[model samples]
Target chain A: MKTINLAESTVRDLNQALHDQAIECTEREWEVLEPKGQHNIACGLDQNISVDIKGPTGYFCAGMNKKAHITIHGNAGQGVAENMMSGSVRVKGNASQAAGATAHGGLLVIEGDAGARCGISMKGVDIVVKGSVGHMSCFMGQAGSLVVCGDAGDALGDSLYETHIYVKGEVKSLGADCIAKEMRDEHIEELSELLNRAGVDEDVTAFKRYGTARQLYNFKVDNTAAY
Target chain B: MCGIVGLYLKNKALENQLGELFEPMLIAMTDRGPDSAGFAIYGDEVPEGSIKLTLRHANEDYDWAGLAGKLKHELNVGVEWFNNSKVAIFKIATSDGIAEAFITENAPDVLILSAGQSIEILKEVGLPVNIAKTFNLKGMKGSHIIGHTRMATESAVTMEGSHPFSTGMDLCLVHNGSLSNHNRLRQELQREGIVFETENDSEVAAGYLTWRLKQGDTLNEALTNSLKDLDGFFTFTVGTRDGFAVMRDPIACKPAVMAETDDYVAMASEYQALTTLPGIENAKIWEPEAATIYVWERSSETGVK
Candidate 1:
């Protein structure tokens, strides 16, 4: 395993090394040390490799990632794994707002709680949080699924679209158009697969599904009050 | 976008190093906000019934020394003043209302930055690093400090528009993010007899908190009220006489991270600001939940925990 110390190496050097190895088709395991909660660490990686960050990271860590498996041992700042495509980002600790925001296709997992808007405007990214999520966790989500193991804050899945939400705990409130839906066999199977992928063990039967009511999908005049 | 940094030392051992720890944190956010910077430091509690006011004037040559003598003679009270460029802080044995009224009537051009027993606010339009040096912020010692670097999305870049806005005694607020309904809220607050010093949306938020506190709401309750009443994307870190608090808007588009240890509790718009803090690696770091009030007060009533 190759090790890079953020205190000694610049972010550019780290990214360049990762990019070079990815382009060369050299599979390498990398470890980042002394990250010290720096911003933009391991961002914009397009490698099919594994990178473990020893400490917390600031905004946009692993942003725009593609085909990389990034793990943060400590908490992450805002927008961790944002806009990711075809990769997995895991945070052992909590994540700040907008985690995995606007991502197209990837799996993001948070072992601890997540701040607001965890999957805001998300498209096709699957998110699994083992702990509670703050308000508006799935605001305007377009596709994929959000699985929460703990209670959800107010306005969960506000104005959601297409995305499926499975919460094992109580939801403080739901946003416009986002309503609890039936959890069928297919949904339970999907949630079980996601939980398994995130390495979380929980009974699929304990979760409730939430999705858009489809009433405001066409922007009818009757829904003006909701807007 | 803007950057905010707050450091509240739970252990009195870290009091003297408040500025030393906060300076690097504030400067780390230079990329987020470069237009202006400001800070509110809490320390040196004045005697009972006395107040401290930090004031500023547009004219660099404004005679702060002369104003101190005049205030002493006119108010018939003891007044001590410290001048820094366009800013001057006054300590007077008088009520906050009386001193504020005196300044309003006598020195109409001087803008009051803060008035409290323990808070001293210094802010100006410049890069965060430059502003820190200009105010000699690294040399100031306090129990807790809150700082802001503003990019000026809602208002022009001026000292008045800069953050760490103080609308209540020993209370100051620094915000990151713009308010969507500031104009309407400002009008509402104005109608309720709350005066504003700037057109900045953050000032309205500060005024709202001050108004709520005046109505007998605790700081935590006031922050809770803000979540329902204020409309916008905001991450606020507020400093008070006894402690500091943090709250994020429900949507919470703006970023905020907090770290707590046995010795101190620190908050920043980004975790990078906290990297330089002592014992940060072992600190219990987490992202503050949306619309939740996280308060840390020095246990004065019942000794330190």
Candidate 2:
């Protein structure tokens, strides 16, 4: 197993080096020894690879990734895993604002809290935050699954489409067109599977699911007030 | 109506061929502005530059040769006319302070667009297709770019009346909405000896902002000042030499979203205008704060646990 030392290099240098090597998959890991506030690390990798980042990362870390399993040991900044696709991204710590915003497909597992608009405009992805999520968690979500163990902020699932949101804690309030659906056996099963994938120790039977009532799918002249 | 689109590849080594990358995006939003277009693509190896001195003729009459010669002597760069008599873009040699000095003395209304190694702009008046071919934007290649289309409402529809105008130095601006305090600011800037060009609110905002930045405020600070001072419904994105900033008016009256990924961040007036090809996946998208300023550098550093 080779280790990639990023001690002396800037984030730009390390990112370029990784991209140039085309070293998609290996035991080789990049360690960020002393990072200040840096942004956009390990972005746009379309190959299947395993990367482990040691410390806290700045904004837009591991964004727009596909077919790569990236894990962050520390907290991630705004727009963490923005537009991830067809892969698994697990954050061992909390995530900043707009976590998993507009992700088309993939899985983002955040061990801690997520800031506002956590899944805003989520296209098709599954986000499992072990802790709480901030306000407007699922604004204009088209399709996805968000499982939160802690309470969700106001407008948790506003303007949602096909995405299924499951939260264990109290919901402050629901945004327009979002409501708490009955927690059925299938929902619990889905929650259980997601929890397993995220490696959460929490039991599967204790969560409630939320989603859109499908009142605002197509555009309506009468609904001009909503926009 | 002018539309400007800017893109940045988070870690990609973007260089040279900015016109190539910007061509498609400009073409996509041709309907926004149909008058005239121009651009400047910065690179890591490129020298630091100041602003673009945009001249908009009020009543469509002005002294061309005399002004050109005067600016050439003062700023040490020959003026290049980009549009008809309506527009001219000067590649001036000056610092932020000098640029401010020029604005304070002349009080010309400028539109600040995008800057930085990753940001480049392409804009035109009639059709994006014509501008693309004329500039050969389709054949170029770069990791990031921005484009603009113009439709004049408050402005003259002349070359200077389009989108993405600046002071021939550090700042570039593209606006999607109008400013409420434009006339008031215009009067204020005029009193400061900043020459007025067109009656465009975008220019007044740019001029006022450039002057503010020269006063030692960061771009965000200047933007904050504008937000507090300039009223009305608007959304604007500005690019500087190493950074880019986006802001909305007090009402958040216009639509602007930051669709970001590990690869890049896309901001546009409308979501559909941004999601044309969709290369990046699994990226999150969010909205900027109302009446707030958000800025980011060209690249970022990342790691995993």
Candidate 3:
């Protein structure tokens, strides 16, 4: 394992170390010290390595990540794990707005609450939040699953499509074309698998599923009011 | 994008260090907004029935002393003034309206930044670090402070366009996101006889709150009404005579985080702004809910109303 002190090293150095796939290199794990809530740390990584950030991070940390495992010990600013292609990013504390936004593939876990638009425009990412999510979480989600152990704010899953949402707590409101759906056995099993992978110990039966009603999928003139 | 930082000290021991503590927090968000920066400090309450107005002139050669003398002669009150470069602060033993009228009629080139017993607003079109140095923000002493760095999406980058907009006496507002309905709202406010300083959308928000507070609404009530009346993505941190308040729009597209310790309650656009505070590691940190008003007051007797 190699240790990189952000206090003494630039974000470029950290990215360089993470992108170094030389044959002579042996270290696969790295520790980021004194992050001090810097923005865009460990961003744009395309390696199957692990990065443990010691403290909080500012906006867009681990953004556009691919094939990397990133863990933040403290809070994260806006858009954490945004547009990620692959790999996992875990925030031990709370996350600000747009967490896991527009990600295609990967698993993003928040042990604490996530701010507004937690999974907005998500394509194919699996997001698990142990705490509450603010307004507009999972807005316009196209695919993948978002599981919340705590309450969800207003307009949950607004304009959602094909995404599966499981919440154990109360939902403030649902957005246009988003409605509560029945939890079938397959969904229950999938939620169980996701919970197990995220290392959360919540009962699958405690959760409720929500998704798009598919009424506005084709944009018929009869459904113009919903627009 | 913009950056905001606010600190409300619960413990009197930290009051003297308010500027020292807030400077770094403002500078931390340099990348978020670098066009301009501003802050409002609440300290040194004037004697009862008196007010302090911080004024700025575009002409550095403007005679602030002559203006102060004229105000004293015209208003028939005691006026003490301190001039710092293009900015002048006057402490007057008179009604704010009277002093404001006098300044408007006499020092037409001067712009009144703020008028209150405790609040002093200093802002300029420069980087956060340079603004801080120009205003000597590190030496200021206050009970609470609210600062902003602007990227200027809705308005031009000018001194008047910088934030911490003071629309009401001892009250100011700093906004992070743009408003969609500011033009219509500004017209509506204008019809109601509300005067605006700049074309910035944020000024309309400040004016709206000022109108509400003048209509006998409390801070929380005004902010609550804003959630319904204002249409946009916004994260607002308001500074009052006593303490401060924070709120986000319903959709909450913008980011905001708050941290509270026994000694203070701090809020910023990001968590890094609060990391330098004492005991932050043990502080209770959370994101304020969208459209929910979170307020803290200095006087224990005055709870959130």
Candidate with top lDDT is: 3
- lDDT digits (tens) for residues A80-177 of candidate 1: 99999988999999888889999998899999998888899999999999998888888999998999999998899888889999999999999999
Once fitted onto the true fold, the runs of candidate 1 whose alpha carbons sit more than 4 angstroms away are A176-188, A211-227, B58-62, B96-100, B191-193, B212-225, B299-305
Q: Could you report the DockQ of all the candidates, in the order they appear? A: 0.67, 0.03, 0.77
> Which structure is stronger by TM-score: 1 or 3?
3
Interface RMSD of 2: 10.5
| Tens-digit lDDT track of model 2 for B1-305 | 45566765564643444454456666655555666555434443223554444443443355556565666678666444343334334444543556435544764543323333233444445676876675566655555555567666776766566666563244677787777779988998888777666898888887887778767886767888887788776778776655467787754546565667766666754433454434532346455656667776654322100
Superposed on all Cα atoms, model 3 deviates from the true structure by an RMSD in Å of 2.4
Per-residue lDDT over B190-245 for candidate 3, one digit per residue giving the tens place of the 0 to 100 score: 98889997899999999999999989998888999999889988999999998998
Best-fitting candidate, measured by DockQ?
3
**What tens digits encode model 3's per-residue C-alpha lDDT throughout A1-227?**
89999999998888787877432346778899999888899999888888999988988999999988999999998899999999999999999889999999999999999988999999999999999998899999999999999999889999999999999999999989899999999999999999998999998999999999998788588768986
Best by TM-score: 3
Question: Could you give the interface RMSD of each candidate, to one decimal?
Answer: 1.4, 10.5, 1.0
lDDT of 2 by residue, A1-227 (tens): 33444556777876675565456444344554443324687787676667788755666888998877788876677788899877878888777778899999989999978867898899998999988987789898988799999989878888888889999899988999998889888888888888888888887667877899888877788879998
Q: Give candidate 3 misplaced runs (Cα > 4 Å).
A: A22-25, A221-227, B300-305
